[model samples]
Target: FSPIQRVNYKIEETRVGRLTNYDKLILEVWTDGTMTPKEATVSAAKTLVSYFNQIVSPKKVEKKEVKEEADVIGPMGKLSVEEIGLPTRVANALVKAGYETVEELAKAKKEDLVKVRNLGEKSIKIITVALVEKGVKFGE
Candidate 1:
């Protein structure tokens, strides 16, 4: 299977309810001839008002401008993981253990991988070689 040529995704609230949180997400994938396929996944929605109705303390939603400007730079979220060509599980383990970005992966030592579960000898060797090819070295 090939990777997606282009895609966009967003998360939204689905339903207004109490004591439950639901999420709705929209994903759009692009194909040839300028064609775009869109899909929406919905989850059960919950609102702070519903919590207040049930006499539970409701959390506040602070107002903030979240819109992206026309000239936003750099990738977001899991895109970095894809660019590095590492397994998702490995990338997540690295990130969770305080590895922020690809540059950090180069300088990661053996002990770092040891700290992550399931990153035994074989996995460490594979990752190390891959990083070396990318000119990433431990303590570099």
Candidate 2:
């Protein structure tokens, strides 16, 4: 529930190339403390675009079945490094070093992680604490 506080719109006659009678809509949206105005506007725009797309296509769109990350990795392994509350720098380093998931990080040796760029003892300690809080052990 994104609490939008206010919404305003204005229509103006505009020209698009040779089309001089085209109407352009300008929307101004405001939100409560719950969500940012930009977020609300983007969400509304996406919803409208989707509806327009469906209207134009008419035919029902077939949704492809996407495999869940948990299926490829273990359940806990599907958790992203960022989800463990690691700092952006530390998480980026781990992800760059092919430790994107909690399972991969949990299985990595401290020495191996230390070899990764931008990671050190402090980062490792932070990662360890976060993993332990999630009932996971750092390192094999």
Candidate 3:
């Protein structure tokens, strides 16, 4: 979500309480009940900004947690795909196909690895070079 200069309306309120951008300033607006849309938004924004400046609390940011699925990745999150040094498309396909680590890819049989949709002989050769660079050889 993009940050606004000022925020005044409730973005969403669920059972977990009001969910909003951590950086936004949420405030209640009380107009004469006959204000136009533009006037209301402008006035409410001003009040929100004013209140935010007067607040003493520090802003909080939410951090996202990355979780690897066990059954899917199958004991293979040790090495990053970037370390494989394969061409972009092939390396990305390998990662997407659940080979998370170079060691895991090295353990696979050539015949089996050839079955992957986007990977081909040229990509396989590239992968071999990458694995050899890391002191690993496929089908060892």
Candidate 4:
């Protein structure tokens, strides 16, 4: 059977020709360098054919996903926020301050962070620095 996706391969040595399915003949195949139209030698071609047979398998259907009424976009929806390794304290602080997104945090000012419960000058400075390092601006 023909490959559904043409495998990109380079021949590293010389090869030969052989008969394939549908009684069609495969000829001089390049073994040492790259893919070529020329048929390979009989033995080399047989070896390549065998290798190809062993490596390639018929495609199979993976587990089916149940259709849903809603659609999610991008990698963000696939993984939970916890999977992204945000610190619990930081997340809690953000949630308490009503800042649930990176954009919101980036746009926050020093005074805004100070207004949040349990937050102080040191925490604000640290958060500001971290946000700036991530290319987010607070006072800009």
Candidate 5:
């Protein structure tokens, strides 16, 4: 994301400026002709997108060795929530809701966790991120 690509303009002199993407070819925006900020932004963005789309560029993809799923340990069903280093409150809530292990937590849905006491959106996000790092996902 370039600072030049996105920006908010204020009151300035009505003039023309050139923006270049690649090949050193200049794209001149006739902002003086544009009435509003919306018009200028839309005109500039459309010009860039259309110009780039028209350019033909071929990209090559390289095949890499695929890792077998069997190599990953997968979910830890026998491990407790505390063992996974979850927050005390979140772990307590999961335990109270009958989700003791990582496997149980992975099986739970977003709706089910919302019903659990003391667990909110933030807690769910943390739990989901941790589980994802362990190759465990909830709600299939």
Candidate 6:
């Protein structure tokens, strides 16, 4: 049996500026009586570092042309809620309510969106503003 009893993680996206974003990862690990949580965490970290060291090199890498989903899904509607740059909590709430894309959200009624968990008038207003900025509007 493994010494780890449970593991949990949460990822938060924070915007540093207009174009820069950073992700904060929070990890919680539980262990049985056999090993201390600190020891287990240290071991995991060392293992990850070893793997990363093996894959990474000192040479410079070339950047590739990445395609945007908007090209395939249309224009603004295809854009993801995260891409719209809403707060992490708001974006997660919207996605949880089955509104993953801007187009899907635009077609949803304000009353229905308000019923989603953790969403209220302020979140609705934020969504409205974001959609408007993208040249879209919510359904009546």
> Model 5 misses residue 4 by how many Å?
62
lDDT per residue for candidate 5 within 15-69, as digits (tens), equals 3457433243333333343255457667668998887876755355688777543
lDDT of 6 by residue, 1-140 (tens): 78999999999986767744788888888998798988999998999988888778544678977755344235887789999979999999989989998878877899899899999999899988987877775655
TM-score of each: 0.37, 0.46, 0.43, 0.37, 0.46, 0.47
- Residues 1-140, model 1: lDDT tens digits: 32336768799877766734788878766645433342211111245446666676556779988654211222322234336677777777676777656555554668767877766777677677665555555433
What are the clashing pairs of model 5?
Answer: none
Candidate 3 local lDDT, residue 56: 64
Error of 3 at 81 (Å): 2.1
Show model 1 residue runs off by greater than 4 Å: 1-82
Candidate 2 residue 112 C-alpha distance from true site, Å: 0.3
Q: Model 4, range 43-105, lDDT digits (tens) per residue? A: 446888888886696447698796431132222324332233456776677677777665556
Q: Indicate the worst ten consecutive residues by lDDT in candidate 1.
A: 36-45
lDDT of each: 0.57, 0.84, 0.66, 0.54, 0.71, 0.84
For all predictions, the C-alpha RMSD in Å is 22.9, 18.6, 17.1, 13.9, 15.5, 22.1
Q: Show model 2 residue runs off by greater than 4 Å.
A: 1-74
lDDT of 2 by residue, 51-132 (tens): 9998888877799798664444446677889887889999999989999888778778999988999999999999989988
Stretches of candidate 5 off by over 4 Å are 1-75
User: lDDT (0-100) at residue 3 of candidate 4?
Assistant: 16
After aligning candidate 1 to the native by TM-score, how far in Å is the CA of 15 from where it should be? 99
C-alpha-based local distance difference test score of model 4: 0.54
